[model samples]
Target: MKNYLNSTMIKITLMIVLCMSAFAFNDSKVSAKDEAIDLRAKAAILIDADSGKILYEKNANKAYGIASMSKMMTEYILLDKIKAGEISWDDQYNVSKYAYKISHDTELSNVALREDGVYSVKELYEAMAIYSANAATIALTEVMAGSEKNFLPLMNKKAEELGLKNYTFYNATGLNNKQLKGMQPKGTPEDGENEMPAKYVAKLAYQLVKEHPDMLETASINKKAFAKGTDDEIMMTNWNYMVKGGIYEYKGVDGLKTGSTDFAGQCVTITAKQGDLRVIAVVMDAKEENGDSTYKARFDAAKTLLDYGFNNFKMQEVMPAGYTFKNNKTIAVKDGQKKEVAIEASKAISFIANKNTTYKPKLVLDKKEITAPVKKGTVVGHVEIQGDGYGYIMPVKDQATVVTTDDVQSKGWFVKALGGIGDFFANVGHSIF
Candidate 1:
């Protein structure tokens, strides 16, 4: 880990590191750029989780009804509260009439919350994440903020904090008023429906996992029983087909959520890991084929995007050991045993890059020279990997440890101070010349 740049500068730098290749996955054949996959999604995005690099996107910034995919934020807020010690996983809450109605409604998915049944925070969260239990989410919201109405403000505040310009949370469960059968509070913004751009959702998912990685502990659960040891106990299975043993389960798919609705159609946000690389892929508003709108389109689209990434991209060290940046040069080191210390990369750098393109990175130093007493492992410069189609600019810091010159015995304090003053100006001159 290294201090690379300010947040804004890193974003700007990442935005510029791109190469657009004309290729899209269709069946087993890689088609021409113009023949991009007909994902039939309103919006989508595939990105590198570590580098924030966009691999592919279609209408990624356009807002659309997000359906249950909005629950990721809910999960984020819940974990945040729990982690903050405001709540505990063992704390119990009784199911409300509202929660019971949604659970037994049969029209929506649920883990069958009974108004009389008491459940722990952990149980409800599991139902929501793995089973997309609408009632469980509403119930948890009730416990968290005393009621769904109060919880709405917290969700909106979080969205703003996250800088989600294209997202709006209207309900804890991602349902619109119509889906709620008029149960939604009237005249309140939270009573409406939720909407967000596909890319922002991806960013949200990435940020959620990055910060609260332990959320995956429950999100990855593929199957479990609700109300265990009680007569009301019911089995819950993950809706995300990308998970293991799912109908369309792909390799490496782990914790994630899926969503579907009349307006939102079908959607999924997925995260997967392969060795050093982790990626997030989002598919939203997937169209139903031949009026048979099943979840297959969303699954297939997500798979296609992920397949495009794992097959075509490889994570490479931006400036690995035993390699030198093109612009790196030896600089004079005052009071050192050696007259000069060779400038070298200080830290490790790696990024997901296109397998098809060759990388030729350039090195940029913050300063061309340094004074003696420079400690080992000091950061003096960074390596900027040139972008290509799918190229991402990652600044690998130049570490002081990599600089090979040694320090010599100093004369007396006065002598060393005098030598430093003269060499400081000299090094500055050399830097300019």
Candidate 2:
């Protein structure tokens, strides 16, 4: 009997050891996965383009030089003007001395423009979008705001209107003012360049892609000859090599922007689509293991972010339609046949998250109690999602409308009057007490 008891004890100990081993193995796997996604950039952000859910971030709020990526603001402003009928693609612009000089500077990206050349808005926009041509960008600013100096105010005003809280725009071309050869905007530092946090950069890219998807047509062009069959024609190549037929071609990568400068290093704001899943990634000032910035480092960081998003997370319905909040299923109704009315989420809320993620629904009522005679489907407030720490890229998109589940009739007039009298006496009694 003693030998049998000792054997049983030994088996139990072995079982516990095996269970502990399994748990430790699982924990190590998770830790390795978390460590594998490190980004080699000064700032980075990954967001679900469709739902505006942030997947990952690193130093996302710290401001850094954006270099040519600043042209995205120029693109947004131009697109806004075209949408409002304030300008047309056919509108013609005369190259200014600033634009003319910049175009002739061989060190910069530009299409040479003859002094007497008249160019249409479409041509210059294509040059700016496809080639990151500084001269073409400046000419468009001249067309829109009369000069790049005047366009500075427009950029800041639009940034404010778009809820971009941290940003500074010094030029339309995204060129360092020192490179402008004393032509930098008045009252601005001569060596200044455009700067913004990674979050704002992602926001600007999000707004641009959402509002003006048509811009992708120009931005996606891999290579095009400017002024074909003319003496001044030059081959304009897209700086975003991730586009189709480029060195680092990525699937579903059609539009966006790239930038590089001594101060900014290498930066890219990339967008990609797979099936119904769309994601945007921004990598700013990417560097090598040795701490030297390189063009490939930006693309590498962006690729890692994009892969992490597409592989780890998927868009799923976190909260179902008609879902009821557990703690607040019904709301009080004043003078109704029933004392309360049932409420539910009017629509489903979906977002990108991992399989292990969980969400809780929170109901926020418009008022403490709704008036009687409420109609079914009447909006009461909104249902918000409380996730497992991860927040949304756009918090407003994570809400669903909350509505009354059924109609409630008003109480009989005599009953309401009697209840009112009883309530008054009760109040008086409480006050006397």
| Maximum-TM-score candidate | 2
User: What is the C-alpha lDDT profile of model 2 across 1-433, one tens digit per residue?
Assistant: 9999999999999999999999997655231123357788999888878766677788888899999999999999999999999999999988788889889998988899888888999999999999999999999999999999999999999898788867888898878999998998898999999899998899889889999988888888999999888898899999988899989888888879999889899999999888888888999999988898888898888889888877877777888998998888998999899989999998888767665455678888899798889999989899777653446556565788899999999999999999999999999999999
Local error of candidate 2 at residue 249 (angstroms): 0.2
Q: Which 10-residue span in candidate 2 carries the lowest summed lDDT?
A: 27-36
Clashes of each: 8, 0
- Write one digit per residue (lDDT tens) for candidate 1, span 1-433: 3455577778876666532222222223321222265676778888888876777778887898889988898899999999999999999998788888888978888888777888899999898999999889988899899887788899889887777776767688887777666667445553477899887888788789888987777777778998888888888889997888778877778878899888788889988887777789999877665645569988888888888878877776655753554545666566654555666765565667666555555666666666666655555665565543432212322222345333433346887788889989999999999
Q: Would you list the C-alpha lDDT of every candidate in the order shown?
A: 0.76, 0.87
Q: Could you tell me every candidate's TM-score relative to the true structure?
A: 0.74, 0.84
lDDT of 1: 0.76
Task: Candidate 1: give the clashing pairs.
Answer: 19-388, 19-389, 22-33, 337-408, 345-399, 346-398, 346-399, 377-401
Task: Say which candidate scores most in lDDT.
Answer: 2
Query: In model 1, how large is the Cα lDDT of residue 421?
Result: 95
Stretches > 4 Å off in candidate 1? 1-38, 189-191, 288-292, 321-348, 363-381, 388-433
